[model samples]
Structures are given as C-alpha cells and as structure tokens.
Target: MNAVKIIAASPQEALEQVQAQVGPDAVILNVRKLPIDGMKKLWAKPQVEVLAAAPEQEPGEQESLRQLAVKVQQLEGELHARGVVPTETVPSPDAKLPPKVMQMIRAAQGDKLEEALLPAVQVLEQIGLLPSHARWLSAQSRNFLGATKPRNLPEEMELLREVLSEYWHQLARRLEKPGNPVRVLVGTPGSGKTTVLAKWATQETFLRQRPSRIWRLDADRPNTAEFLSLHGELLQVPVERVWDPDEQPPEDTLRLVDFPGVPADQP
Candidate 1:
C-alpha cells in the first residue's frame, strides 16, 4: 500500500479526509500542526499535516514489505552507530523521468485525480519516499496504469512491476542522454554514497556510451575507500585518487566522485 499526506484545518478533519480518500484501512503514521509564518499566523486557522498509508491487500506483499522493514531497521541502526541523523533527501534537479513522465505529473497535480493518486502516494511514503516524490511517482504510476485497469490484487501488483520497469528504462535513457555532466554523491557512513556513485558511473560509461572519470577525494577527513578505484578499473574508466582542492574535471568528461566516511558537520 502507498502513503499520502493530507492537510486540513483540524486533526479530525484530516483523518476523516484520509479515510474517505484512502479508505478506512488507512494507517496514520504522523500528525503535526503546521505553523504559518509572519503576519499570516495571526489570521490563519492552524493546519494539520497527517501522514497516512493504506493497508496492504495480499499476504505475499505483506511478507515483502516485512523484509523491506527489516532492512530499513538495519539501515537506521547503522546511521545511529555513526552519530548521524539525516532529515531530508533531495533529488537531483534532472531527476525527472521521461517517456511521457511529465504528462503524468501534470495529471497528478489536478484536484480531480487526488483520490485516485492517494493509494500510490501512501504506499510510496511507507516505503521511505518523501511525500512530494511519492505524489509524483504515484501520479506517474496512476497515469501509466490508465485505460486498461487491473482486475484483481495480483493483476494490480503485476501492473506495478511493469510501471516500475518502464520508469527504470526511462531513467536509463535519461542517463544515456547528455545532461548533468558532473555528478556528486555525499552522505554519512552506510548511506550508500559509494554504491550510488558506482551505479551512475556505470550508467554513464556503459549504458550512456560516454567517456567518464572517477575522482576519489577527501573533504574534511582522509578518504579511505578503494571501492571506486577498483570498480573504475573494472569498468575501464580513468580513476583519480588523492585530495585535490584546486582540481577541475577534464574538459567535457563526466566526473563521478565518492566522498564517504566523512562526518556531516565537516565540509
């Protein structure tokens, strides 16, 4: 099931709206008052921000979701072990998916599809997507699943898988095209910064068919990961090591850098 964010004048109103749109099976995760800023705070009625999700339909999905939950817990433990707390994850400016992806986004923003988009949105949030990204993905998925409707739970799950595959393809095509010439990955320990850099670098050199270079540099502390260099050798891409503050990426060549194990407070 997907998660959705609902805003209303009161908690009761917000809960009622979530139940109405997402059905009574909706599970409320968080509810907080939204503060208005400046002079508007004086006149505005307090708004409630409620994060809720719909119940899953199938036993198989329940198991899969349980596995995902376990993994999330593991990652949380890892984060705490490193003294880091990440509040938000922002997507890249060119993060949009293609193959008619923008059209679906337009449809989702309309008030008419609000109800239809809630289920996808709710499920996405429960799985860790920010509400905005969840809404966008749900909107795209809703439009992607149009015309031919799913007849049953199994059919609906199958459609979801198909939609996911199509989105991945669009993402690969996005990487294959000439855009975002420089890519940088940053995060605390065990946050997949290195893994993310590897995937994107792979996409650039192999999938996108472009020349690329990997830079391993230290920011505040000494960088100590050999993963990128080994992977670069395997991928037949040039790998540069050591801390270089005055350096610039080679003219017109894609640059992938992995700066891991650095504390968030540092540069």
Candidate 2:
C-alpha cells in the first residue's frame, strides 16, 4: 500500500487528518520531528511528519500494531541517540523528567526544597494556566509527598502521577447531576467543547446503554465543526442540527448538546 505523508503541528491534528483522508481504520507506519532550517530553528515551533496508510489493502489490526510498535521503537531510539530521551548513563538530576514529558525538565534545581516544583509550575504557566492554579496543584502535590522529606526529581514526578490519577479517577465516575438529564458542553473556542461532548456521548450511549441524542447548536458563531456529526453517525446517536433555547428538552431521554465556544474575553 502507498503511504501518505502528513505534516501537522501536533499529534491530534495529524490523527484527524489521517482519519479524514484514509478512514478511521488507517494505521500509522512512522512518525518523526520535521527539520528546521537556518535561523528559523531558533524561534520556529516544531512540526511532525507522519507516515500512514489505509489498512484494507495492507495488514490487519495485529500486524498493523506490530509495525507501529517497531516504528515507535525506531523513533525512540533515534531520539535517544540524539540525547532527546535520557538514558541511565546521562546521570543528571535535571535531565530526567516525568514519563513521556520532555519539556518539563528545563527548570534548574536549586538548593531550596520547594524549588523542585519550579519546573512543573513553569510548564503549566506556558500553557496559559493561571499562576494561582499552578500553585494550588503544586501545594496538592506537596501534601501527597509530605510523608517523604526533601523530595528528589523522581519522587516529584511520581507525585504528579499520583495526583493526576486521584483526580481523574474521580472524574471517571458517572456523569450526571441528581435532577439533570440534559447536559451542555460549553467552553472557549478550541477548548474541546465538541470533543468533550463526544466523550460524554460515548459514556451515555454505549456504556450506560441509555437512550441519548446529540444537539449541535450555535453558541456565538456557527457550529461548523464536523466532528460531532461524524461521531454521531459512528455511534448511531441521533444528531439534531439546532434547538430553540426557549424550549425545554424532553426529560425521558438523555440529550448532550454541542455548543460553539465563546471568546474567553467576552461575557
């Protein structure tokens, strides 16, 4: 099978492009960071090169996964050789980071014990997280790691996993309030409102075995994202184009609505 070359800014975008072009059954063959030239290397954000192809004409699921795993090992080896993935021989406290996280290793370790959390806080702030929120998370991590004194980098990383696991385990429970059957997903534009709706739909429809439908309504702008419609078709969930805000939804069946994101600056 002929493979298609895709260059995308992130893995999610690359996956979306592959799904759109080669169908959801498509298998990824290889992935790598694209090269930057000249002075562009100083300021340019990195792009990823993905090699993928349709599977019906090629290998089945098991074969596809094996090929994908081999490709991943090769990619990881290349990164490790280039000093991107740290090995045991490196032996630097600052170079090692949390599993699968490469950028969180930048903060220099200082003499103060609290400075150990500096790297995580900086990473959060870089992604538009508020300083206050970062501090709160850091404090929470400290609480879990309190029994152990003078935590090292590895211990701090383990603390992050523990905190994340605790919070996400709570979030994985049933999604509903006592009196609410209709739930609407709302957020700033590009904040994954539709994606969250799809997840909720999966739980409501497939896992719960409950009757559910999806409503795609405009929030401030037109809800142009095709993801909801595509996902609705896949799950066999009835999808409606729009609904009048003045009308109350039927109480018997669960209704998940997809809303366009409002600007964060707007009221």
Best by TM-score: 2
List TM-scores for all candidates, in order.
0.37, 0.43
Candidate 1: stretches off by over 4 Å: 1-113, 118-121, 145-147, 175-188, 191-214, 226-239, 242-256, 261-267
Residue range 128-205, candidate 1, lDDT tens digits: 776666656655656884536766334444566667788899898877855455567877787868766765665565
* RMSD of every prediction: 25.2, 17.7
The residue-by-residue lDDT of candidate 2 on 134-199, one tens digit each, is 656676777764346434333444456568778777786655357656677777888967766766
| Residue 43 alpha-carbon offset, candidate 2, angstroms | 61
- Position 194, candidate 2: lDDT: 76
Error of 2 at 32 (Å): 33
Candidate 2 residue pairs that clash: none
lDDT of 1 at 199: 57
